[model samples]
Target: MKQNIYNFFLMKYSREKIALLISGKASFIALFSLIIIFSFLADKFFSLSNLTNILDLSAILLLTSTAMTFILMLGSIDLSVEGIAGLTGVVGALMVKNFSNSNDYGLLSIIICILLGAIFGLLNGIIFTKLKIPSFMTTLGLGAVASGVCILSTRGYPVIITDQTIRGLAHIKLLGGVIPLLFVIAITINLLIWFVSERTILGRHVIAIGGDEAIAKDLGIKINLVKIMVFAISGAIFGLAGMLLVAKLGAGDIRNPYGLLFDSIAAPLIGGIAITGGIGKIPHAAIGAITLTILRNGMVLLGINPYIQQSVVGTIIILTVAITIERKKIGVIK
Candidate 1:
């Protein structure tokens, strides 16, 4: 026992291990730091109501950011997130008991919306791979297409949900209303995705491809399939988020999911996922989501200007990416 204890302490610590350890905790550190600063800056920051608000606000952002993390890990960006979310929210609204339609699909509506998101993602993957288009261009074009569809469907009007059961789902609370059911659902799903990313072949391939696509291709990795799966998975999560958004807002508008794209991307990046790709964890996205939520929530509590808040978030993104980026690996710029 004495020998074992000594050996454990004597174990050599490599620089790589140290670096990884620090990288993994960077987001947590940022989250804690924000909490501490906010607690001091805003009297209500640490209150139960405020904390609950932060968690509730984080639900959708958490789901979207976690999905975005995988896309970033694949060295790709999904500009279609906002458009897909808007479209899916509208679809979910229209399909459910809504003022715009008599259709009351209930849970089935959610499933179709999620599946629609997956189909869009699959299309994005196919176009990106088979058509040899850059992910940026393909996703951007698809996003615009989605937005157009959304506008056409809405015809410049909002769809108010009339389904009491569906709307009530968002308002359901646990622990005497201290915790929201929607946030719990988001956390559960995030855990599932984290497991997939850490323990599955697809997840491993995503990291490998992002790290070095040339080597991954040479080593028998199905690059296209992995990329497609990642995007599809993200799309499905985005769909779920859209449905929940509709439930919470009791209406669906093209602008319902406004700022989601920015929040999703910023959360992952702020959490230590490199924009350049191939180096981060799913949990980091969750942490980043909470951090961003708290930052915004605290700002509002402190009476900060809404416009300046946007600037702060933008600056944080730029700074975090600069700090965590794998600059040595990316030797050239276009």
Candidate 2:
């Protein structure tokens, strides 16, 4: 009887392991399929200039998506990405040499922007935990408040930057001019995050809570603290993204981060991170970011209308969620 039971459990574990492997590989399969299709549809897709542009464009999205991965892993959402990024971009723009301001803090301004993002994220965590607000609602309200502040402070005008040093971040390329410098910076930060997720106790606790909150509580994990820390970290990345946006656009404007919320959320799901959380890795987010970037680049190359492109993203998000959501947890649709 004991041997029979051992064999039975072994069979069950093997089946589950197989399923997980297939699910993990799905994103890579989709990404390669996208590349093949786009290469044929867009003649310039393989050219150095166009490939460099894709890398450049993917940089900001990559940062934001990695941040989003943490929050999503906690079974929470952050809709304030655009708002925080916009606010920091506008602030960073005004702090540096700009047509709209007299300040020129140079590199110091970048630090301040990232710190500001952390503050905003910290506030989100405190409010959500203390007030028992839903993460989505809390982030949404805060994001709107941030956007309002950006618009009100700037009076709807973009702060055009005059700092050439910072602006060079967008123009500089590496690796035979096929990779943007910004992409390198973004990748470095993401590597640090990946380490945190894979190597730290905090990372394990995050996955623990997402997998089973009650069990995590019984395990003596400080769930609230972990959630708060994750939010603050995500916010800092948003802040950095804002600064990068200013560099790339050569200006700070509330409108500059228009599609950020969608792209950040979409990338992880596309990369095969389960919406239900606790079942993804850092590399999944990287794959997702690159895949989404390529998707957008291909759409532009194909001359698709900007409006329709949004619809495609929305469809992808819905489809990805449907496929990856934990069905047992979602017994019925409200």
Candidate 3:
């Protein structure tokens, strides 16, 4: 009877099922393990205040990393997030009731900021698809252009937001102050992405393209359209992240998104998303973002040198990609 039960269980969970389970659970396991370690190392780590702080910090990173997941799944990279985010933040702040501008567009400014992000993202897709430019170079050049625009708009000054409602968004709490509204927004966006990725035809096409672009094309998947849409969606998400940052800071500076690009890219990679593509889930990226936030928070609490913290993160990213990347798919290491 035991043997039969064991055989039945084996039949219920095939190799693919087991692999998927591992991939999905790995990030959570790592997160919990770190939590345990940090709890022991830092007395304040498990405190409610510190935990809330970690979640607060994780919000922006979580959003950006979620955006990056789509592009990364297609085996492409986006280097434009930081610049786009900074530009959007500046635009959002300037359009709203602000110190630098008389225009009080209020909610319209938020929509405009998101639209601007989408437009830039669309530009990325057009240039890459129509011009035959590689995503790496295309996004890099576009990011630079965005950065220049941001500087030109601000003229080396920060714009202080005067919209009380917008500024208050950063402070709203939920669930007895254990959760911030910003975190709620981030999670909601992630859930939307998850639904699209797991339920829609576009999601299937995306996965197909990532698995093998050549095969996807042969199978009649609209590669260019899908890629463009992915980029545009990513851009919109980054734009929202920028606005959130501005709301939190109550001001918009061109330097606001300084380290976002790295954090977004690193989070997914650390979460075991293969850089080679086609092998990750949205939840994994979230887990990775939370883990990174915890790591940074713990480091600060433990009095670790800031420089060393960066080095440690970089090393972990390298090791993660080395271990998780499917080298066979890449064909060559350049």
* Top candidate, metric lDDT: 2
Work out how many backbone clashes candidate 1 has: 0
lDDT of model 3, residue 213: 81
- lDDT score, candidate 1: 0.85
Model 3 residue-pair collision total? 0
**TM, every model:** 0.93, 0.93, 0.93
Error of 1 at 213 (Å): 0.9
TM-score of 1: 0.93
TM-score, cand. 2 vs. native: 0.93
Tell me how far the alpha carbon of residue 176 in candidate 3 is from the true structure, in angstroms, after superposition: 1.2
* Residue 85 Cα positional deviation in candidate 3, in Å, after optimal superposition: 0.3
What is the per-residue lDDT of model 3 for residues 1-334, given as tens digits with 9 covering 90 to 100?
5334333433443442454466567778778988999999999999999998999999999999998988888888889999999999999999888888698888777778888989999999889888999998999999899989989988968999999889988899899999999999998998899888877777776766766788678666799999999999999998898899999999888889999989999999888777767778777788899999999999999999999999999998998787666656766778
Clashes of each: 0, 0, 0
Better by TM-score, candidate 3 or 2: 3
Cα deviation of 320 in candidate 1 (Å)? Answer: 1.1
Q: Estimate candidate 2's alpha-carbon lDDT, on a 0 to 1 scale.
A: 0.87
